[model samples]
Target chain A: MIKQFPIQQFLDENGKILNKDIRSQITTELVKNFYQHCVRIRTFDRKAISLQRQGRIGTYAPFEGQEAAQVGSALALQQDDWLFPTYRDHGAAMTFGHSLRNILLFWNGRNEGCIPPEGKKIFPPAIPIATQIPHAAGAAYAEKRKGTKNAAIVYFGDGATSEGDFHEGINFASVMKAPVVLFNQNNGYAISVPINKQMSSQTIAQKALAYDIPGVRIDGNDIFVVYFETLKALERARQGQGPTLIEAVTWRYGAHTTADDPSKYRDQTESQQRRHTMDPLLRIEHFMKNEGMYDEHWINEIEEAAQAEIDLAVQEMEEFPVANPADIFDHVFAEPTWGIQKQKEEYLRLLEVNP
Target chain B: MMNTVIQTKTLTLVQAINEAMDTMLKENEQVILLGEDIGKNGGVFRATDGLQEKYGEDRVLDTPLSEAGFVGAAIGMAVNGFRPVVEIQFLGFIYPAYEQIMTHASRLRMRTMGYYTVPMVIRAPYGAGVRAPEIHCDSTEAIFTHMPGIKVVCPSNPYDAKGLLIAAIEDPDPVLFLEPMRSYRSVRDEVPDGKYIVEIGKGNRLIEGEDVTLISWGAMVPVALKAAEQMKVRGIHCDVLDLRTLYPLDHELIAESVQKTGRTVIVHEAHATGGVGNDIVSIINDTSFLFQKAPVERVTGFDTPVPYFGFEDHYLPTPKRVVHAIEKVMKY
Candidate 1:
C-alpha cells in the first residue's frame, strides 16, 4: 500500500530535473533564495548544537539532516500565515523570521527566547508531540472566517503522526475547509522508536485518505520538490480549497535530541553516506551548478553572510541580561493562583536562605 | 396588581456551554471551537449543537482524534491572538494533551517574559456518575491544578457554568474548565440570558452554617448541597463552600468558613488520595490550623478506577457519604 505513494521527486539526487513540467517554476532568484536560507538555518542549527555541548544552552533538538523539509516548507509560507512548530522546528522558525537572539535565549532557558519578533505569527515550539495540529486548524479556520487569504502551516515529525491530535486536526480542517497545511517530515524514526513499530499504517500520506484530504508524498531531500509542493498546497489553502497533508520523506542524521544517543538504535554510518548523495543543501548546490546559476563569488558571499548573521545573533543572546528565577512563577495566569503564589513564595524563601 | 416581565427560560449545563460558545463567537472574531465531532455532529455529547450551522464550519471545528495536536495548536492560536476554546470530549482522554497544557499553554506568558500569552480554555466533561468507561469519567482536576500557569475551574450549577465560562473565554490566561457530564442536564438553573462574568478564585457559600464547612466542586457541589439539607434535620448546620475555581482556590472563603464553623469537611467525586480534597485539607492545616476545632474530614470516591456501570454508585461520593462526613466533623 505504501508503494502506491512512491516518493514523488521533482529533482533527482544528482540535482537533475526529474519533472520537466514543473521546472519552469524554478527561477534563478528562487533557487538562490532557497540555498541562502537553507545554508543560514543549517549553520544556525550546528551552532545551537555546539552551544548545547558547551553547556551554554539547554538540551537542543538538532535538525541537521532534515534541513530541506524545514527550509522549503517554511520559505513557502507568507509573512501573515501562522506557523505551528515543534521543539525541533527552530530552523523553520528562524527561516520564517523568528529572532535568532530569542531562539538562542530559549535554548539557554530564558523566558525571553520564547517571544517572536513583532508581527510574526510564530508559535512557541510545542514539546509534546502532535499537539499543534488542532491549533493550526483553528487559526486557519479563523482566517477563513475573517474573509482573509492568510493560511496556516503546522510542522510535525513521523512520531507525531501517531498522535490523536494529528488525526483530529486534519479531520477538522477537512470538514471545515480550513486553510492550513499539515506538513509531516517522515524522518524514518521518532526518537528511539522506528516508524515501522509506531503504527500499522504503511505510509503517513495514506492517513490523509481517512480525512478525505489531498495527500502528497515528496522526496524531502530535493529542495525543489519540497519548495514547489509546499507552495502549491499553501496556494490551494488560500484559494479556499481546504487543507493538504504533505509527507516529506527525509532523514535525521543527528540524535533525537542532545539528551539522546542515536547509536543505541540506528546505524550512524548510513547517515554519513547519505550526506554526500541525498543532502538537501548539496542537492540544491548541485542543481545550481548544473543549471549554471551558481557563481563562485555569490556562493562564497552567501556563506560569509550566513556566518556573520549567526555570530551577531550569538553575541546578542549572550549580551542579554541574566534570567531571573522569579520569572518562572509569574504568568501561569493573569493573576497567580494561590498554589502558584505559595510555591513561588516558598521558592524565593529557599533562594534567600541559600544565598 | 404588580406588572411582571417574563425572562428567557433557563438553560442546562450543556446548553449554557453551547450558548457561551455561540455568544463568544458572535461577539469576538478570534473565538473558535475545535474538538472531535464538534462540527456537523455537534460534538459526541452535542454540547456544541447547532454551532457549526450557525457559526459555520470555520468557527466550530471538528478535529481528528488528536488531543495533543489540537491542544498544542490552540495554545499556538491563543498566543497568536486567537481565543481558542478546545474540547477534550472526556476528562480521561485529555492525558495526551497534558504536556501541551502543562508545558506550553500554562507557561507561555512566563516563558516569553510576558511577550505572549495563551488565552485559551480547555473544556472537558468529568466525574463518575455518568457510568462511562474506565478512563472516560475520571475527575482529573488535581492534575491540572498541580500545574503552575493555568487556571482550573469547575462550576456546579448552570448559572455559574455559563458565567464562569464567559469569564474564562475573556480571561487573558489559559483556563481548564471541567464540566460534569453526569450533571450536564440533571442540574439546571435560572442562568442569566445575557452575558455575565463570574469572578475567578472566589468560592460561593451555598448554605451558611455554624457547625461544619463542607468544601466541594463540580459534581460534588450538588452532593454537598443535598448532604447539607439532610444534615439540617439532624441539627447539624453544614456550610457548603463551592470552589468554582480549583487552582486559585478562594482560600479566604474557606478559611473564613472554617473559622466560623470551627470544623470542615472536603467532598469530591475523585479518588481520595492526592485529589484536590487533599490539597484543600493541606491548605486549611497550613493556614487555619489554630482556628480549626477538628481534624479536616474528606468525603471522596475510593482510591480506585471509576468502576463500570454496576459499581458506579459505590465508586462515586454520594450525598450519604457527604452527610456522614459532615456529621463526623460536627462530632469532632
Candidate 2:
C-alpha cells in the first residue's frame, strides 16, 4: 500500500528533468524566484542559529535543509490566502510576507513578534504540535462560506500526523469541503524522536486516504515539484474540491532547535553527507546550471542583498522599545476585567515604589 | 399616540438559552453554531432545537464527535471574524479539548499581542443532581477560571441564562458558558423577548440582609437562596449574592457585602481543594479582613471525584449544608 504513493519528482538529484510534461510550465523567471527565496530563508535560518549561539536572540529553530519545502509551498499561496505555520516554519512565514524584524523579535522573546504586517492573513506561529491544523480548516471554511476563492495552507512535520488534531482537522475539512491544503514536511524527526518512532505509517501522505482526499508524496528537495504540486493543490481548493494533503519528504540537517543536540538521538554523518549530495539548494543550483539560467554575478548580488536586509532587521529587532510590563495585563481581553485591572495597578504601584 | 409593550416569554433555563442563540443567529450573520447532534438532533439536550432548520446547515453545523477538532476549528473561525458558539455535550466530555482551550483560545489574544481576538463561546452542561453518570456531572469551573484571557460565566436561572449567554457571544474574548444540567428545566422564569446583556464580571444581589453574606453561582445559587429563606425563618437575615461571572469575580460586590455583614458562607458544587470558593476567601481577606466577625465558612463538595449517582447526593452541597454553614459562620 505504501508503494502506491511513491515519491514524485520532476527534477532528479543530477539536475535531469524527470517529468517533461511540466517542462513548458517551468520558466527561467520562476526558477530564479524560487532560487532567491530559498537562499534568503536559508540565510535567515543560519543567521538565527548563529544569533542564538551568540546569545543575541533566544533559542531558535533552524530549517537549513528544508528550505525548498518551506519556500516552494509558501510561494504558491495567493496574497489573500491564509498561512498557518508551526513554530519551526518561520521560513515559510517569511516567504509569505511576514516581517523579518517581527520574526527576529519573536525569537528574542517579545510578544511584538507575534503581530503580522497589516492585512496579511498569517497567524502567529503555533507552538503546540498539530494545533494549527484545525485552525487552518476553520479559517478556510470561513473563506469558503463567504463565497471567496481564497484558500488556506497549514504546515506541519511528520510527527504532527500522530496528533489527534491532524485527523480531526483533515476529517473536518474533507466533510465540509473546506478549501485548505494540509502541507506536511516529513523532516524525519520531531525534536529527538525519529519518524519510525513517531508512527507506523510508511508515508504521511497515505493518511489522507482515510479522509478520502487527494494525497501526494513528492521529493521535497526538488523545488519545481514542491512549488508545482502545492500550486496544483491550492488550485483544487479554489475550485471547491475540498482539502488536499501533500507530504514533502525531506530531512533536517541540524538540531531541532538551538537547545537540542541531534547527535544524541541519531547519527550526525547523515546530515554532512546530505549537504553535499542531496541538499535542496544544491539540487536547485544543479537545475539552474543545467538549464543555463545560472549567473554567478547575479547569485552573488542576491546573497549580498539578503545579508544586508537581514542585518537591518536584526538591528531593528534589537533597538525596538522595551516591552511595557503593563502589556501583560492589558491584552488579556479586549477590555481588562476588574481582577486584571487590580493586578495591573498593584504591579505598577510596586514598580514605582521599588524604583 | 403610540402604544408600547415589552414582550416576555416564560421559559426554563435551557429554553432561554435557545432563544438567545436564535436571537443572535437572526441578528448577526457572523454567528455560527457547531456541536455534535446540534443540527437535526437539536443537540443532546435540545438547546439548539429548530436552529438548523431556521438558519440552514451552514450556520448551525453538526460537527464530528471530536471536541478538540470542532473547538479548535471554532477558535480558527473566531480568529477569522466569526462568532462561534460551540456546544460540548457535557462538561466532563471537554477534557479532550482542554489543551485547545487553555493554550490557544484562552491566550490567542495575548499571544498575538492583540492582533487577533477569539470572540467565541463554549457552552457545556455541568453539575450533578440530575443523576448523570460518571464524567457527566463534574463541576470543574475552577480549572478554567485559574487561567487568564478567558471569561467563565454560569447562570442559575432562565433570566440570567438568557442574558449571560447573549453577553458571552458578544464578548470580544473567549467565554466558557457553564449550563447547570440539574437546573436546565427545573424551574421557569419570565425572559425578555429580545436582546439584553447581563454584564460580565458583575454579581447580582438576589436578596439583601445584614446578618451574613451567602455567596454562590450556577445551580448553587438556588441552594443559597433556599438557605437564605430558611435562615430568615429563624430570625437570621442573609444577603444572597449570585456571582454570574466566575472568572473576573465582582470584587466590589463581594467586598461590600462581606464588609457590611461581617460574616460569609461560600457555596459551590465543585471540589473544595481548589474551587473558586478559595478565590472568594482570598478576596475577603484582602479587602474586608478588618470587618470580619469570624473566619469565612465554605459549603462545597468534598475533594473527590463526583461519585456515582447513587452517592451523588452525598457529594453535592445541598440547601441544608448551606444553611449549616451560614449558622456556623453566624455562631462564630
**Share of real interface contacts recovered by each model?**
0.66, 0.78
**What's the C-alpha lDDT at position A8 in model 1?**
94
TM-score of chain B of each: 0.96, 0.98
Local accuracy of candidate 1 as per-residue lDDT tens digits, A1-355: 5687779999888889999988777899999898899889888989999999999889999999888899999999998998989989898999999999999998888778778898898877877777778778877876877789999999999998877777767876887788999999999999989989998988888888887888999998888888889999999999999999999999999999999999999989989999998899898888988999978899889989998999999999989987677776675566666677788899999989996
TM-score of each: 0.89, 0.99
Best by TM-score: 2
Q: Evaluated with lDDT, which candidate comes out highest?
A: 2
> Backbone collision count in every prediction?
17, 0
CA displacement after TM-score superposition, residue A217 of candidate 1 (Å): 2.5
DockQ score for model 1: 0.52
Considering every candidate listed, which one attains the maximal DockQ? 2
